[model samples]
Target: MDQDQTYEYRGYRLVAKPADNGARCWAWRDGVPVHKLIGCDVPDAIQRTRNAIDSDLGVAARDGDAGDAAYTRALEAVLPELSTGQLKMLQARYRAPDRIITATELAKAAGYSNYSGANLQYGNLGKAVHAHHPVDLPVRSNGTLVYTCALADSPDLEPSATEDDSHWRWRMLPSLAFALCALGLVAK
Candidate 1:
């Protein structure tokens, strides 16, 4: 029974009721209806359904795995600043429909080492975010299910000196006054 379950794509769901007779049709993961063959002249329907199923399974499996891997990386990155409970809190808050999760949120929720840790060295905290390595899990809460977890851009990878370019900063102590002012905060 796909009822009460979320497919999150193609709008597939279980439909117990049927329009023509008692012949129910699966959401086909979308508006399409999945049914039995009526005649040889009504060809290609079964094969097409099979193809859709296969394609859906293939993509879901691949993407799901990658999301798991990326999460591993994210965990490694978050570990430096947050306790496990905090990390879980983030998952509970984010990773649902209409929510756009980002590295910054992960860092904050996990108590990242600093404000910009999401885009800095020692940020990735892992080797890499391989494709299809993350498997997004749906957690049940208050009888509600939602999507959580993401996979991509290894959280373990150190922020290289290349993500940002052409934007640079420079400073100058044009006079002794400026130098003294800058050093005012230093030890006497």
Candidate 2:
């Protein structure tokens, strides 16, 4: 039987509808559709939505904030699980001005022939991070089970600045950046 489970987090209302394949989840803020996802399960759906709220759409740690400890720990836990391509993509974002990067640019930086590869790798990396810490949000698709979320800031939608700008551009969180530095994952 399909049941609609409703929840509230970070001032957003979440509804998860379970199906044969998985759960379809949605989040609304101030009655506006802010995000959606097809999660592997009901809890996964809700957790993913909560993750988005806790990290991406909310105020994360700023420079030198002690509140960043959780993000730092999560990144450190997931570091060993990242592939070279994934690490490269993260390094590129780390080196980018203000830590903001587009998927296409990240693909090129990580030596992937296409953005699709970068999306997959990055999304998978997001899963790894999520495994270590559920609070780290990874963007999920409303339509498919594809991993499009990267282990970075949720993403700032920049509409129509360019063909690429139409996509959600990511900014690396300060905690993740500092974690990379602390672990010597990126060159100083």
Candidate 3:
């Protein structure tokens, strides 16, 4: 390829090279090299390089289609009571790869100051989840903590599940909930 040509995948720029029988690749931005990899074949090398660039472009945590769908569904359920601006701020929490909103934080968003008290008067977001089907719980970034509103009257929600779909769900008394749920109170 010509030096004038550039490969843009996700948000980073990659430089392509041809090896004896395959392709080699690297990425740079502002003179900083972020990744270097050798692919088994030319196409494989290009794909690998593109994937590396994409994964590193602040989307290290790529959500599966199911995760994205869950986000949209939950947002639809949570947005009606929120002013457009309020919704925007909450959306920002999910904008980056690793932001977590606690129950306390979400409580404030719902206009409740007490961490335990919920603002679930009729037509409120909380009320909707409790009244009907549960929304898919959002996955947390590796170190984030947030409460899920899935269980009734419980202040606990599960953290992000691993690739195998295993995680912890806390209850009102985290210890007790942990004890019982640890024994298998949560849905798999």
Candidate 4:
């Protein structure tokens, strides 16, 4: 029952407290108790707490919370090369996550009156995606597609350091194509 004792587990501070049945381990984040593992001994409770923290962190990373900066940088690197219409469509698609973006919807967002204009804009966006992202993004028959901003699928697309600054260079060249392929850039 000593509240003073605490142990760090998976970047979380955990405290083991004695309960009537067994010991309960509580994990704290930013000094707030976030998780609790009851009906276990100190070691088991600690392990459970660690597992919970690891799972939470993994989910956060996958959900675009942990790697937001890297994702933003990757998108920003290709932003300049995109046209105004493509940029507008991309922004609209990104805003609607987990939802299918249709050509009509894209056209409306891009200030186009007809679906054909939106379809053309979508084609431009597809080319941009292929040139910059180089990822296999599926498009449905209705021109419906789900756009994810995270670079989780493209692990080989890493940010390389330069002599001047530690920024990711987005310049695509024929010479670097071989290297990029070797790094699984061309692989689906």
Candidate 5:
């Protein structure tokens, strides 16, 4: 077998390599294998890997559409209420190479000198949205507010001895991303 080629796309790390029949690819998040595919060729394998990742992220609809109508409407309803800083943070997350961003990175994107400002605004963003629509949002067992849950997916990580906000990461929800595009907040 030749050396495996790794590619990062939309927050997933894809590894592609040769197989007996043709090629194989795997999608990984935070170093854990989440999905796999076998293709007739290397490029096919890579494309299939990307498709799987996008489908899991909800960015790629299995039925050849952009998003679910109800979910997109729900996100659009809350988007108008987001502050400029929060919107910028979301845009930054969407543009991130791997689509994952930390609080400090979000602060920088939102023009805040400190992460605290971003943190506060993010929490408020989530609180407001959760107050109205409580479905499909991630919940934490610790009772602490995980603001990222409202609009983003958190990295899959083992619970550490101490939870650190500075190290936390967020990836924008696909539904929200599509809504943002529909609302002209970002390009489609």
Candidate 6:
């Protein structure tokens, strides 16, 4: 098949031609063949090719290494069972480095009309973090939360003065008591 026979769509040149075994589609970017789509209809192949190109371009534009590092940290923080939306939220949070993110902001970015949906997603994220990490995250009255990267030093885990310190202390008391009991400093 002649390489000249190609179709351009969304900055990608697609060519459906004969391969050694069967017909396949080749997607080229900047005169370099980047992807091969096999065993799919022409439209499907074209869509897949466009998606691949878009994803590649997005990563390239966003500093792929930094995005990858943030994504990796997010993966470590969250549970294995995560939805794509939840994963995106976590990635955005991790990428921002010391920013306190709210469910409303995450929901807005995720294209949701209401914070309720985002709240549920954030709840899931919190559960995943608590289950996996040794530290408990501080939660605000408005349901906002903060997460610093694992590389951060001397993170302030203290509850706000306005917030009920008793609530926070109570939540951690069981664990603290257990440690004291283990050290024989306190009776069980």
RMSD, one per candidate, in order? 21.7, 15.3, 16.8, 18.3, 9.6, 18.0
lDDT of 6: 0.44
Candidate 6 on 94-180: residue-level lDDT in tens?
A: 333232344455666566676567656656654554444434345558875433222121223553233432212111111221222
Off by over 4 Å in 6: 1-74, 77-79, 95-98, 137-188
Model 4, position 120, has a per-residue lDDT of 62
Q: Model 2 Cα RMSD, Å?
A: 15.3
Mind giving the per-residue lDDT tens digits that candidate 4 earns over 101-150?
Answer: 45556677788886577656555544544454454444658885533222
The segments of candidate 4 whose C-alpha lies over 4 angstroms from its true place after superposition are: 1-73, 137-188
Higher lDDT: candidate 5 or 6?
5
Error of 2 at 97 (Å): 0.5
Q: Would you estimate the TM-scores of all the predictions?
A: 0.29, 0.55, 0.28, 0.34, 0.58, 0.32
Q: What is the lDDT of residue 124 in candidate 5?
A: 86
lDDT of 4: 0.48
Off by over 4 Å in 3: 1-5, 58-188
Best by lDDT: 5
Q: Which pairs, if any, clash in model 2?
A: none
List residue ranges in candidate 2 displaced over 4 A.
Answer: 1-66, 136-150, 160-167
In candidate 1, position 23 carries an lDDT of: 23
By lDDT rank, best first, the candidates go 5, 2, 4, 6, 3, 1
How many Å off is the CA of 115 in candidate 6? 1.2
* Least well predicted 10-residue stretch by lDDT in candidate 5: 60-69
Residue-level error in angstroms, candidate 2, position 3: 59
| C-alpha lDDT (0 to 100) for residue 163 of candidate 5 | 67
Find the 10 residues in a row with the least total lDDT in model 6: 167-176
Better of 5 and 6 by TM-score: 5
